[model samples]
Target: MTVAPADDVTGEYLALRTGAGVVADRFEAVWIRGADTTPFLQATLTQDMSGLAAGEITRAFLLTSKGKVRALLWVLVGANEVILLCDKGRQADVLRALVLLNVNMDVTIDAVLGPVIEVIGPTAATVVGSLGYDVQAPHRWAFSEAGHCVAAIGHIRVDLPRFVLIGPSSDVVRNSGGVFVGDLAADAVRIEAGEPQAGRDVDDATLVHEVGALDGAVSFTKGCYLGQEMVERIDARGRVNRRIVGVVVGTNVIPPHGCEVVQGSAVRGRVTSTAESLYLRAPIVLAMVRREVVDGSAVTLTWDGGSAPGTVHELPLDTFASIS
Candidate 1:
């Protein structure tokens, strides 16, 4: 769906003024299923899939042999099919990798690049509620047989279920009933929630724990999956060395991605994402800081333009939680 300007804002719309959802700028959808589904995925992904039930959504990482993440994926399990969602740019590589690894397995993979639409807000439920679909708020995935839609709310990744509304973009926009948030607003919400974007906050060189996703994507109890050994070792060591943490910049001058986070003369980490917080009334950021520097300590963000003083805070960095 596309965003349109509106003068009249409902409580739902007001909610969306600060609240936001994602529009599938571009994505690749792939289907994998068969008798070897569990084994195939178990061997390739970082999460345990043997217990995944139909209608459940699981986040996982496709890792290299050396245990570095190659792509972040959202797996949606249907009665007889498992759908994999990955970045459009990485689709070909991921599909190729999976295909090469599908040795004697009874699994099949097909790249389905369709229009994926997302809708989120506090009134997100109200919008979906009007559509005659009951979507459980985030982490829960549901499909609309009649509307040809699939949705999840409040999910760290794939926060909204994408609907395959085969028609004009305008038509889908009208039908979605939720506001079409810009890329900036979406990034802001993601940072506030402490979620990592695949390429921006994580990439091939990123270990799962360093991105603050060890608990969500990696399963320590699962059998050996790609990159499981290194991930397990990091867990056993009781530290990840470097981690993604939130920083509240004192000034409005936003630090660009990869800008250095400094304390005294030492380089502590680098900024991965930054956005203005409508709720918090200050500039907040997500950065990959050396583990030693992330203990709610004060620091400075140095960039080409200037420098701003800030502090390192934990993820889902809830400045509001303390008050509530």
Candidate 2:
């Protein structure tokens, strides 16, 4: 991944110049419109919208009544509209859930895809900057006045990198001035950041607080949302039975998702995702480990016919501190 100076360029434009190639990863952009938009959102997600200003973006979770995550969303609020970018696989389900809950509200939701292009990498901002767009510093998401473009600086998961999403594809590529990075590379970046993928790190059986993303997704002061009670209860208790952590493996062998994590003879957790780090020079993984065993200490993974040495570390891994 290439690194570049921060200036007027956006991440997307910078990615084009770097070696990152773009892929047609399915993504949906949903528009939230109606007088009840704020109320509707407050009741549906874990983030508080009471203080949201236009152009503000937040990371949040859409959950089931059982407190399990249905989807993870990156939300951007506008003057009269709120936009949601969620996993393509769960787009329909999320839309249906929102519609079912908006029976009496003045809100309308529309799904949008295709028109947007996702450009990602460390130098992504430099490419956009060259196009005359001023990107916000890393970890924050913002939109540029260059028509339909949104620039975000952060990790995809375990990989802390910058990314930009430009819309109306035609105009975006023409002006991006950078190379395109495919979804595979993007996925690799996420694994490097140790950021949890929604369906992978969090699913129908996963709880919000267990992922160490409460600060990014849940608001302690937010109004009641679908799974607010359980989340709050976990927060009040000061501990969750399971927590997501980064694991650095001793070998180049990458573990598959769902591989059991073990410490001696006890099953501690399971691997959620794994990849070789381009910058770290080792294999890293994101795993859901028992809270009691999550200290930054030595651990091991037992697989068929083999064992790999590893250690449990915090989320957003140390590699991300500079970018995130």
Candidate 3:
């Protein structure tokens, strides 16, 4: 709600890159418990969840039988329960799907409903450190005596060293003393970082193969999980019809959501998300283009009346070192 101003977003983005910034709120968590919780989730997720240590987190996805995505989830392992992190209100859908399989499993699904404050940028470590918790590695989480758990992890839109302070509220709000960046500013950094977001860049029909960067999301070695058959089959067949890629817009024009990316008169792709990049000083976008769209290929992003010339670039559009 009123996270940042449009004109000031660029400035806030720059600050997030060089120093520290906090997003006081934006995420929610769902609680999955009862003795069978671990095996229940492990059987349904793309990531292996059976061996998570205390205060650890991992990325995963819940998919349909046809291999389409239902949700992108960040699973946090605590002592007595598991926390599933996702975009606000996404837990309800996840819970609903999960309840169908609860026939014999001793599991209870509930929402954590916490305020998730994100501390990000190169200085993320410093900011959280001052708050009496150490988040040294990505996926590593630690909780303070006050019940606040901070996990070093990226959001749906992965950028730099990002960490989330999650609880009933955030100590970072009172202790970190960092500058606050709103959703607008945080979003610009996301596009610049080239991470596709769930519910925005991805949808119910979107498959996991379309999203770039599976560093920690999927486990090919794991046993059967929901939608695993399709995942394995896709790998064996070697490629999906379309994959998400980045495009550097040639003009100042921002591609509206769902705008078509055309190759001559043929529509080859659709723009899913866009942002004005201060680093590039131009608009950049995430588009699901046909796998045939070769790297460095030139394309046109067509909106209502006009089109902007753009070049297809691989994901991770902006270099991490460049921002520093």
Candidate 1 residue lDDT tens string, 134-231: 65545556566563446462445333333322112435456455666556666666677787777788878888878665556778887888778888
Candidate 3: where is the Cα deviation over 4 Å?
A: 1-6, 155-159, 168-175
- Per-residue lDDT of 72-134 in model 3, one digit per residue for the tens? 888888766787777665667888888875679888888766688787788878877877776
* Model 2 Cα lDDT, one tens digit per residue, 1-324: 233343322342324324343434445667789888988898889988878887777778888987888887877777767888776577788888888878688888877655655555555566556556676655455556755646463443445344546464634455454454444345555655556766677778888877665566788886688988888788789887988888888888877778889987899999888766555667788888898785678888877877788878775554544442
At residue 50, what lDDT does model 2 achieve?
72
**Candidate 3 residue 317 C-alpha distance from true site, Å:** 0.6
Candidate 3 global CA lDDT score: 0.78
- What C-alpha root-mean-square deviation, in Å, does candidate 1 show against the real structure? 3.8
For TM-score, the strongest prediction is: 3
Ranking by TM-score: 3, 1, 2
Which is superior by TM-score, 1 or 2? 1
Model 1 ranges off by over 4 Å: 1-22, 132-138, 146-149, 157-170, 319-324
Q: TM-score each candidate.
A: 0.86, 0.83, 0.91
Cα lDDT for residue 161, candidate 3: 84
In candidate 3, where is summed lDDT lowest over 10 consecutive residues?
Answer: 1-10
Q: What lDDT score is found at residue 171 in candidate 2?
A: 49
Per-candidate clash tally: 4, 36, 1
